[model samples]
Target: MLGELEMVKAVLSGSRRTVVLTGAGISVESGVPTFRGRDGSWKNYRPEDLARPDAFEARPELVWEFYNWRRESLRESEPNAAHLALAEMERKKNNFLLITQNVDGLHCRAGSRKIMEMHGSLWQIKCTKCTHAREDFSPLPPMPECPVCGHLLRPGVVWFGEPLIPGVLRVAIDEINKSDVFLAVETSSLAQPAASFYQLAKDHGAVTVEINREPTPISGFMDFALHGKASDILPELMAGLSE
Candidate 1:
């Protein structure tokens, strides 16, 4: 087992590019319920039935209801110390990129620049017909058509059956391949393409680090396994790096 302190020290002092992959665990610190625990919706309801594009198309109202509830939940939460630590890392170094699976905008709010949101964002909405993008914070009535083109409005997220945004995926892949250090933070290590990102980073000769409370699928493959909550561990690890 690599010493957590020594691993972080090496990350701070390393010369190659650094890439960060964040997941639901980081948002858990901000009071957002993860999708895998006792209260996780995935255990009770099938995400494919709810998160698929077909579901949204057949019942936009239902889809919006879930998303709106999520939006409200996120509104009450604040960015935690772990998010701030990443921002601190950005300030201290020039070769870092933060890639997140969360729809919450906490990372951006915490001032982490160079972030690539793999799943898209809740703050953004778009017209299904005209590509009109809007960022609205309030609940909306059933949007029947695009304001500009009369097309049905939809959430700006990658649905269960949809492909990821090509531009964002391209950037993430490029960064992972270019990095000399890659950190997987608070992720389940089971999510599809996202889990694969860590392997890509490793294949590129980057040192891979996993920060989670428990062992995950890729635990054995990681160079360092830092066991703790990101909010508690990240701040402590980064405390001395800003100097």
Candidate 2:
């Protein structure tokens, strides 16, 4: 098998246009619970039900309760070393982009400058009427009202049935299309559209790499597969580039 350092060197020497895609798995190291895990449940509701538009419309209070609890859980969380390593790596690269499926705001906290959040952020809220959005860390009431238009405020997130923000998807696609080095870091490669990026990048003649604790759907197609935690693997990858 090729050594991890060899993989890192190969990635770095491969291209200047690099794109890194991150998912919930990466945040696991920072103590964030996966949405499907045991603690992800609130009351009798499944996580999927709570994140749907119909649920929020029916019982905004209950949905807000889950969100408020999540905020509390996320309040003290810090970015793991993997997130930091990605930020630092981007700094040294000429053209790089970080596309993430997380709403925890950890990538922003880690100082990543060029990022396309595929999902909206938990720290933000959007008005159901107008197109107003802003960071809101305030306590969630049973039904929060949009400060600008007095309309119902929804969590600024791409819920289960919602489409990704068009602009954000465009950027992610463009970055992936142009990248010569594409890293799927801690993602399951199962989220649709985003999941297809590994293939898209490969089709565009990019070197596709997968770094995950276990094999994902596209593992067999990746040019390089590193089975491990990104928290440990990413730093080693960076060190290999420097060596």
Task: List the candidate 2 regions with Cα displacement exceeding 4 Å.
Answer: 240-243
lDDT of 2: 0.86
* Candidate 2 C-alpha lDDT tens digits along 129-172: 89988898877787888878899888899999899997888878
Per-residue lDDT of model 1, residues 1-243, tens digit only: 336667676676664578889999998879988877877784256555788888887888788777777778888999999999999988887888999998888999999978988888988889887768988787666553578987678878888878999788888888899898888999998887898988898888888888898889898999888888888777777866643
Best by lDDT: 2
TM-score per candidate, chains pooled: 0.93, 0.94
Candidate RMSDs in order: 2.0, 1.7
- Each candidate: what lDDT? 0.83, 0.86
Model 1 ranges with Cα > 4 A deviation: 42-44, 142-145
